[model samples]
Target: MENREESRLTSAELANLWRLYITENLMYQFKTPLIDNCQDPDIRSAIEFSRAISEHYIVSIENIFRNENYPVPTAYSENDIHPQAPALFTDVFCLHFIHQGAQLGMSKIHEMMAVAVRQDVWEVLNQGANDFKDLYQQSLQLLLTKGLYSRPAFLPPEKESRFAENKHYVSGWLGNQRPLNALEIMSIHNTIIQNGISKAILRAFAQVINDKKLRDYLEKGAETASDIMRELEDWLIMENTNVTATLDSEILPTETPPYSDKLMMMLIANVGVGSLGVYGNALSTVFRRDLGLKFMHLMKDAVQYAQEGLHLVIDKGWMEVPPQFPDINTR
Candidate 1:
């Protein structure tokens, strides 16, 4: 037996501990009621797959800890779904929310994996990261196949010639010429509420996420978003602005989600990633440097989520098929 005095935990060992910590936590969060409510079977499957992988990882990590004569890290504790709380959403919506959360988690993992000190740990992370990429791709495919994915509502004009004649540059760096109008104030308030909703979504995912590192990262993101929302509200109040903090409940589709639980979750991740650019541009247009800095942070988080979601999609062969190359020899 290895002595306790020795640094028994190698980089690989530590990495496994981190992996197991996240997976076990996730297993509890993704139970039958949660699974049953999912609209997409593919999404449900993916979650199950993730759970299985995590379980395997946990076992592997425990073995490593045992071999190294190190005490295994205690990560997962209880499967406590509070009795008092009402069900917040249907299974489909829950899956979708969780999927977005996973994207965020994967993104954080990719960055940390890049800077991992141990080669073995890096290798493990690299493989796991690729798995997430596959998952993302599969989710996208399911969305497309089911025709449930939401396309960007605002489409540019169809005729290229029509765009050539119209050119207008609107400038508002020093604030709008007129004092911020009611409409503009309302828009700002709407944005803040949207931000809050997104933060809540992240928090929900963090609760169910299997990875400790990912959970920690997501929790941090939720906190950061909450802070930004508070600041935005404060600014609105100072300007005597009327903020419409409530989300438009009628906007989101109420139709039963068409896909399986797993697939639906994947779809949600894709949508969330797709929305990042819009958020980035919106903030850039309306906010000053002080506010802009917070937006930048938000952008960073969005990019991370997008990258991870994309990785999952690609790995799963769910994205659009690449075009076939012409036969050079025949040509």
Candidate 2:
């Protein structure tokens, strides 16, 4: 048996660990201020729980990196944190962030775990997944108790299962479309919620950024988020479904940033890039011809905006170079 437990880190394990370290580091940075500024005790406790878990993961991965003789990624650090900065987001938003982040983290951990060859690596990823799953449950319970979470649109139980009657059922995102099936409804609700979060993040980042060009760029992104949400919500409306919560009020008026402008830009860019994947996945699942086309249109705009943000980050020298294989084909 190949003892992966003692084996050298494969490229996949290295890459996943690097990505997870950066992700956990970002969460820890945000969680510190969030925990300090949180009002409600329950929410504060939940965030504290999340922060603790994130710290554990951060230390774990750092140790692995050191053991492997791999220089740790300087993703974000104390340099990015502003000690005197006031609350940049509300308590509700903090809870929501933890809730959504934990939920997403579980999925991410599983993805990493799939690529992991080492037994030790699996253990770390597994533990991280379990920890975040608990946090997800905790944050969700609090959001439900506080009436903060917008429940997904209810799918009425079918009296009897039946096959699609005709081609009309494949009608798209607009016009006289048929009622949404389960996957379609889930896709719409998830996209709406994601855009809502994106809008709030952009608004909050726009408030603290000092660069006029960056601020203008963030504001435009926020507008794009609004446009995306509006179209997705229209789908819900057409199906007579419940829309997701608005996060505008969650953004605080603090002009002071908790994170550096560079950090915020990179973080927001990550969000934009991630959504493109979600849209692509949705395209494959959503049966409507026009609905797929709509995703194509939205994805095109998102790609452009993300490219613009990338240029700004590169210009500022804030973007870190990712680990890459040297181009041997140059010869």
Candidate 3:
């Protein structure tokens, strides 16, 4: 007979549940303001869907934690948001926020589902993943209908496929290099788009963040993001192709903050970390020495930014501790 009653939660299950509990609450905190400030009906609907899904996950995760006698972390609450505050971001930004968020959330849900061992945990996570997929599709369609979706540059088919002929194909530093390949162009193009989004987020964040030092850091981050985007755009322009800008160049002047400083820092830092991952992936895909070198430098800068952001949050007591193994040595 299986001992279902006495079964202990695996570490993976515990970690997944704990992290999602925190993440869902964070999502709720942001979505509340977005929903309140959103002017576009389509954007409002997407935000509502995302917030509803997050609420469902939070409730389910809380139930699991309670059943297992685990103390839930004090995640964000109504105190962290101000619904009546002036709109800090535009409707387009809010729409993009939901679209990007759903993509990242779905990826995480799939990862959690892959490692989940408990039957109940697996079911919950799998359901979240399916819901996010639907949400992503809906948000994407809305963006397309509004002409707000900026796709990566497309490559036309060549007369025929050909193998690399000489050493110059991969060379870039010491000698003449061949023109950029389709894959290299694609990687650089995608990196530029991500950088644009990061820059826009940080620019908006810098405007509302009150702490002088932290605001300065966010401004510096925005400058770094711009530098990266410009570099990548230059590479694409060298190939005589049009570059698609993913973020709006203008931000409304709004000093009123919709989210707490802690929440803003956390969200910006999360985006910085995600951008670093994108840079690393692009680095791996580009074979040209120049392209690879650019990605490496950009990634190094992103790492520095992310580390600084983490330290700031920790110093401010805004960082949450995740689940960890017990200190057996001390015991």
Candidate 4:
């Protein structure tokens, strides 16, 4: 056994310690929706696999911390779990979310592991990377088997021509006709509340992930989201708009995830589309350059999030295979 006092943690060790803290936080967040309302058998199985893997990683890291005589960060704990919260997603949505989360986690983990130095820590991270790869593969197979996946649609020649000719669309301005008002400010505040809820959910997931790399990525995202939320709230107060820090009571009750992955996919896709519309409108309506920039930033991040989700769908084979384009004649 490595001597507790003699096992000095290197910079690599310190980084991993922070990573473990963050991933564990995410795992805790994911567990609630998985246990309370996920309905699809296949998705539930995947969640079970993820939960198990995260738990193992957490234990391994904790052992390492103890052996090295380093104080473990208390970023994740039992308090993070929300077993009593009403189901927020149908089984289908739950599976889609899991797949998306896994893809994001994997991408971030790969980046982190590339920089890791400790042989033992690197080995553990590699194991996790492999597990997530397998999980992504399995998810694709399952989606293909169920005919739940679909490829992006190809635009017809006429449609493409029309889109190319259409120049009326504004790029950065708010699309709304009037200047910013109290009602519009209130609407923006609501958006902030929605964003906060999303952060809370992500924070929960962070609590359970074991990989240091994966945890750090989640923690960074959480921090970014929190910053945006604060900014939005401050803007609302500055405008003297009545805004509530909490979510409205009328938000739909959390439902069991649907069995169909397609529904879930559409739901998330629509959210991305909706954000584009909202941001576009804001650009046209709001005259302030700073506010417009903030909206653009939020929209850009949403696009990235949606793209990551789409990649998972494609990787898992839940979407339809794309048709090959005709090759140009070389002669």
lDDT by residue (16-91, candidate 4, tens digit) is 5566544544464446456555667777787777776677677777777787666665543444345555555445
List model 2 lDDT by residue over 105-145, tens digit each.
Answer: 88778999998988889999999899999999999989888
Task: List the global CA lDDT of all models.
Answer: 0.51, 0.85, 0.83, 0.55
RMSD of 3: 2.1
Using all chains and alpha carbons, the TM-scores for the candidates as numbered come to: 0.46, 0.93, 0.92, 0.48
List runs of model 3 lying over 4 Å from the truth. 1-7, 246-250
Worst 10 residues of 3 by lDDT: 243-252
Per-residue lDDT of candidate 1, residues 212-267 (tens digit):
55456556666766776777677676676544342223123322322223332343
- Reference-based lDDT, residue 288, model 1: 43
RMSD of each: 16.4, 2.2, 2.1, 18.1
Q: Deviation in angstroms for 228 in model 1?
A: 7.1
Please state the error at residue 163 of candidate 3 in Å.
2.4
Judged by lDDT against the true structure, how good is candidate 1? 0.51
Which candidate, 1 or 3, would have the higher lDDT against the true structure?
3
Model 4 ranges off by over 4 Å? 1-8, 82-85, 147-150, 153-296, 299-331
Best of the candidates, lDDT: 2
Task: Give the 10-residue window scoring lowest on summed lDDT in candidate 1.
Answer: 163-172
Candidate achieving higher TM-score, 2 or 3:
2
User: What are the clash counts of all predictions, listed in order?
Assistant: 34, 0, 0, 42
